[model samples]
Target chain A: MGKIKILNPGLLSTIQDGGRFGYQQYGMPVAGAMDLHSLQLANWCVRNPAHEACIEATILGPTIEFQSDTYIAISGATIQPFVNEQAINMNAGIKVRAGDVLSFGSIQTGCRIYIAIAGGFDIPELMESKSTYLRGNLGGFEGRALKAGDELEIADYERRLKGVVPEELIPNYSNFTEIRITSGAEIKRFTMDGVKTFLCSVYSISPQSDRMGYRLSGQKIEHANGADIISSGIVTGAIQVPGHGEPIIMMSDHQTVGGYTKIAQVISVDLPLLGQMKPGDQIKFKEVNLDQAQQLLLERNQWLKQHGIE
Target chain B: MIEYIPSGDSAFLVKFGNEISEEINRKVRAYFIALSNKKLEGIIECVPSYTDLMVLYDPLKIQYKSLLKELKILAENISEIEIPEAKTVEIPVCYGGNFGEDMDAVIAHTGLREQEIIEKHSQNSYLVYMLGFTPGFCYLGGMDKSIATPRKEVPSQKILAGSVGLAAEQTGIYPIESPGGWQIIGRTPYRLFDPNRKPEFLLQAGDYLKFYPISEEEYYKLNEND
Candidate 1:
C-alpha cells in the first residue's frame, strides 16, 4: 500500500472528490473541490479517474514525505512544488520513490491548489464521496482538515502516466475576476435599477469567506421590496441578498435552504473562477441569459470530453 | 398554479406558493413523491422546502426545458399522488435545568411559568418543514405562538446535539453540536443523525414531530441506551 505523512498542514487542507451526493435533502452540504477544473486536470495528469479524491490546499500548501512509490500531480494556483530539494513543474505528473520529501514553496497566484495521486487517495466514503464536510464532521480524513503527522493511504496503480497539461487548458486565476452569472429565481424581487447596480458594481471578497459562502461588500443593492422570502432550496453559486443588501455567493459547503432573496446564480462555467478568488479579491458580475449559461456549460463539458479530462 | 424558476445550470425550483402552509408543504411533498416514484431519467434528487422543491439533474443526461415539461405535467395532478404515510416521531425531552440553560429567559419572554411552557410545547404536534442548517436538523412548524420567544441576542458557542430550541415562531432540535442562537429549552437523548444508519436522517420534510416531557431519571436511562 502507498502512504504519505504530512509535515506541515498549511492553512486549510482536506481530501475532496466530485462531491457528496444524494444527501442534500438530509441537510448535508455537497463539499467538494472548489476548483473542479484544476481537480480534473490534476487527476488527468496522473491518469486517474475524474472523481478520484485529491488534496485541496487553500492559500498555503502542506509539506509531506512519501512513504512509497507513486505518481502525483499538482494543479491550480502558482505554488512552487519540490521533490527531495529539487523544484518540479506545476500541472505535470512526477514520480516519487519511498522516503522522498514533497513540499511547496510560495504561492504566486490563485487561492487554492489540488494534488492528485495516480490511483487516488484510499479514504472511506460517506454518502458515496470522500469529500470532507467539516461542519457535519462526515467523510474524508475523519471529516476535518489535515494536520501534522497525519498518514494518508494511497491506492495502488500498476503503471504511472506522466505528462504535463498544455497551456491552453490552464485557467488564469487573476485577483480581479469577472464572474458571469444568470438571473436567479428571485430576480424579479429586485427593481431594474437594483439589477443594473448589481451587474455594474464591483465587489470585494470579505475576510469571513470560507467554503460555506463568500460574503461580498460593495454598493448596496436596492430591492423593490423587502428581502425576506419563503425558505427555498439553494444551490452552489447562488448569490443571496439578505436584508443588508450585500450579496453572498453560496459555495460547495453552503446550506441546503435559505430564506433570503437570490438575485443571481454565477454560471457553471465561471464557478471555477469564483473558487480561486481569495479575500480582498475584486469581482464584478456580468449577466447572461439562462440559455447562454447552459450553452457555456455544454461547451465546457464538450471541451473536457474532447481533451479526455472528464 | 405551479411556477418553475431556474436555480442554476443543474437545478430548477418548483414553487408551489409564496406563503408557508401545510397545504403548500403537502403540494411540495406530493410533487416530490411523484417525481421520486417515477424515477425520471437524469433527475438526481429533489430537496423539498417550505413552499418549493429543488430538483437537481445531470445536465449531460437531461435538459431543463424537457424536465420542466415533465414536472409541469406531474405537478398538475399532485392531489392524486400517493406517498408513504409520514411517520410521527416522539422525541423525549428533559426541560428546565442544565439541559435547558435558557429556560428562565424563555419564561421571561412569554410571561409564562416553566410548567406552562413545558405543557404548551409538548401538547402540540409539529410538521417538519425541511432539514437544513446542519445535518438532520429539522425546521418544524405548528408551535403555539403564545410561548414563542426570539433567539438569544448572542448565540451559544456550542450547543450539544439533541438540544431542543425555540426561536421566533419555530422550534427545532439540533441534530448535531453546533453554534446557534436558538433559545434552548430542553435536551433529548435520541440520536437524530447516525452515519451508520441506513436512512441517516431520522426525520424527513413531511414527517410529524411531537415532543414529550421526560424526567431526569428517564433522560439518563435513554442517554445510556444511545
Candidate 2:
C-alpha cells in the first residue's frame, strides 16, 4: 500500500467522488465534487475511473510527502504544483517516488483544485461514495477536511497510462464569470422586474458560501407575492431567493428540499464555472430555455467523449 | 390536475397543489412510489415533498419534452397506485431539563406549565409530510396551535441531534445536530441517522410520528443502546 502524509492542509481539502446517489429521498444531501467536470478531467489524467475519489483542494492547496512511487495528476484551480522543489505540469501524469515532497503554491485563478492518483484513494465508501459531507459528518477522511500530520493510503496500479489532456480541454478560470441558467419552477412567483433584475444585475459571491450553496449579494429580487413557498423539492443549481431576497445558488451539497422561491437554475454546463467562483468574485446570470440548457449539456458530453476524457 | 415545472436541465417538479394538504401530499407520495416502481429509463430518483415530487433525470439520456410526455401518461394511472401505509414510529423524548436548551423560553411563550406543555406536545400524533432540510429531519404536521411557539429571534449555531422543538405552528425533531431556530423543549436518544442501518433515516415522508414522555435516565439508557 502507498501512503501520502499531509505536511500542511491548506484552506479546505477533502476527498470527493461523483457523490452519493439513490439516497436523496432520505433527506441526504448529495455531497460530491463541486466542479464535477474538473474532477473527471483530473481522474482522466491519472487514468483512474470517472468516479474514483480525488482530493479537492479549495482556494489554497495542500503540501504533502509521497510514500511510494505512484502516478498522479493535478487539475482544476491554477495552483502551481511542485514535486521535490521542481515545478510540474498540470493535467498530465507525473511519477513520484517514495519520500518525494509534493506541494502547491498560492492559487492564481479559480477557487478549487483537484488532485488524482492513478489507482485512486484507498478510502472506503460510505453510502456508496467517498465524498465527504462535513455537516452530516459522513464519509471521506473521517468526514472532514484534511489537516497536518494526516496519512492516507493509496490504491495500487501497475502501469501508468499516457495522461496528456488536450490543450483545449483545460479550462481557463477567469475573474468574472457569466453563468447560464434556465428559469426555475417558481419563476411565476417572481415579478417581471424581479426576473429582469436577476438576469441583469451583477452579484458578488459571499464569503459565507461553501459546498452547500453560494449566497449572492446583489439587488434584492422583488417577489410578485411573498417569497415563501411550501417547502418543496430542490436540486443543485436551483437559485432560491428567500424573503430577504438575496439569491442563493444551491451547490453540490444542497439539501433535497427547500421553502424559498427558486427563480432559476444554473445550467449543467455552467455549473463548473460557478463552482470555480471565489468570494468577492463577480457573476451575472444569462437566461436560457430548457432546450438550450440541455443542448449545452449534450455538447459538453460530446466534447468529453471526443477527447477521450469521459 | 398535476402541473410539471422544470427544476433544472436534469430535473422537474410534479406539483399537485400550491398549498399544504394531506390529500395533495398523498398524491405526491403515491406518484413518488409509482414513478420509482416504473423504472423509466434516464430517471434517476424521485423526491416527494409536501405538495410536489421532484423527478431527477439524465439530460443526456432523455430530453425534457420526452420525459414530460412520459410523466403525463404516468399521471393517468397515478390514482391507482396505492401508497403504502404510514408506519407509526414512537419517538421517546426526555423533556424540560438540561436536554432542552430553550425549554424555559417555550414555557414562557405558551403560558403553560412544563408538564402540561409536554402532555399537549406528546398526546397528539403528527404526520410526516416530508423528510428534508437535513437527513432524517422530518416536516411534521398537526401540532396544536395552543402550544405553538415562535422560533428564537437569534437561531442557535449548534443544536444537538434528536432535539425536539416547536417553531411557529410546526413541531418536529432535529434528526441531526444543525444550526436551527426552533424553540427546543426536549431531546430523544434514538439515532435517527445510521448509514450502516438497513434504512439510513429513522422516518420517511408518509410516516406517522408519535412522541411519548420518558425520564432523563431512560434517555441515557436508550442513548447507550444505540
Candidate 3:
C-alpha cells in the first residue's frame, strides 16, 4: 500500500474509472473521466488495467507528495510536470521515491489532464463504480472534487516496473482538434444548407459548459421541417440543438433524457478529444458514416493492444 | 406513426408523431416491455420517454449497423408480443393548503373548484410512461384534457419529494426534492425513490398509479412510521 498527499489541487480534480453502467433505468448519469483515452494511456503506462481509477485533473494540475515509492504517469493535456524540480516526460511511467514532490504547471494545450499511479486510486465504490457524480454527490472522495491537503491512498500493485511510451504512439496534438461525428436522428429535419453550415462553420466552446454538457456558440443550424421532437434518451457527445439553434454537446454527466432535436453525434473515438477542449476553443465537425467510424475505433483499439496496452 | 432512427453510435431513438397521445405513449411502453423481455446481448439499457424509446448498447460487443438491424427487427415484432398489464399501486396524498402551494394556481388555470380538481385527478388511473428528468421521477400519461395546463412561468427552486404535480396533459410524482416547473396540487407520503432500497425506484416504466386522497391525520400517521 502507498499514499499520496495533495499540496495544491488545481481547479477540479476527482477519482474516475470507466463509468457507471447498468443503472440508466434508475436515472443515474454515467459519470467518469472526461478524457478516457488519456486515462487509459496513463493506466497502461503503469501496467494497470485500462479501467482502473485515476485522478482526472481539469484546467490545472495538482502538486502531490509521495509517502511511499511508486510509479506514476501523466497524460492528456500537455502539462509541464516535475518531480522535486526535475522535469519529467508525460505518458511514460516514472519511479518516484518516498518523500519526492510531484508538481505540474498550467496546461499548454487542452483542458483536462489524467494522472495514473501504479495499481489505482483507493476509493469506495458506489453502485459498482468509483467514478464521482457531483450532482448526486455520490462516489469518489465524498462525492466531490479533491481539494488541497486531501490525502489519497493508493492500491497495492503486484508488480511495479518503469515503462516508456514511444513518441510515435502519442497522439499528434496538431491534428487532434478536428472531431468526427455521425448525423443524428433529426439530421433529416435540417435543410441541406443547415447541414452544410454545421460542417463548414467553426464553433467556439461556451464558458457555460461543464460535465453536464458543452454549449457551443456558432452558426445557427435551423430545422427546416419545423417538427417538435419528443423527449428521448441521450448519451455523451450528442449534439442537441434547442429552439435557439445553438448546439449543446452532451457530456458524461448529461441527463438521461432530452427533448431537443439532435443534429449530430460526436463519434466515440473522438469523444475524449471533445472532453479535453476548454472554453473558447474553436472546433469543426467532420461528418462520417457509421462504418468508417467503427473502423476508426477498431484501428485505434488494435493500435493500443499492439503497444502492450490491452 | 413516425420513424425510428439512429441517435448516436450506441443508441437508437424510436420517435412518435409530433403530438403526445395515448396511443403513441402505449406503443412506447409496449415496445419497451418487448425489448426488455428479448434481452439482446451488448444492449446496456432502454429508456422510454414521452413519445420515444432510447436503446443504449455497448459498441465494443455490438457494432452500430448490427444493433440497428436488430432494432429494426424488434420494432416489427413488437406489436406481436403481448404486453403484461402494469401493477396498480394506490398512493395516498394530502391535497390543498400549504402541502400544495400551487393548488390555487392550478385551480385558477383550469377554472375548476379545488374539490372537483382533486376528484378528477384521483378518479383516473395513470400509466407510468417513463422514469427520467430526475431520479425516480415518473412521467405519467392518461391525464384528462380538461385539467390540462401549461408549466409554471417560473419554475420552483425546490419541490419536496412526493409532491404531485401537473404540466400540460401530463402528471407526475417527484421521487426526490428537485427544481420543477409543474403545478403542484398535493403531497404524497410514500417514498418514490430510495437509494438504500434494493431496486432504488419504487415505480418502473409501465406501472399503474392511482391517487388516494388522505386527511392530514393519515398523512402524519404514515409519516410517523417512516
For candidate 1, the lDDT comes to: 0.90
**Model 3 residue B73 CA deviation in Å:** 3.4
- lDDT per residue, candidate 3, B11-55, as tens digits? 777776556676777777888888889898888878777678888
Candidate 1 chain A has its poorest 10 consecutive residues by lDDT at A157-166
lDDT of 3 at A285: 92
Superposed by TM-score, candidate 3 places the C-alpha of residue A268 at a distance from the truth, in angstroms, of: 1.4
Candidate 3 per-residue C-alpha lDDT over A225-246 given as tens digits, one digit per residue, 9 for 90 to 100? 6635766778889998887878
Better of 2 and 3 by TM-score: 2
Question: B30-63, model 2: which lDDT tens digit per residue?
Answer: 7887888888999988888999989999988989
Give candidate 3 regions above 4 Å deviation. Answer: A1-3, A67-69, A97-99, A174-176, B1-4, B15-19, B79-82, B108-113, B145-150, B217-226
- For model 2 the local lDDT of residue B198 reads 73
Best by TM-score: 1
Candidate with maximal DockQ: 2
Query: Which residue pairs does candidate 1 place in steric collision?
Result: none
Of 1 and 3, the candidate ranking higher by TM-score? 1
Please give the range of 10 consecutive residues that has the lowest summed lDDT in model 3 chain B.
B193-202
- Per lDDT, what order, best first? 1, 2, 3
Docking class of 3: medium
Tens digits of per-residue lDDT, candidate 1, A43-75, equal 989999887899999999899999999999999
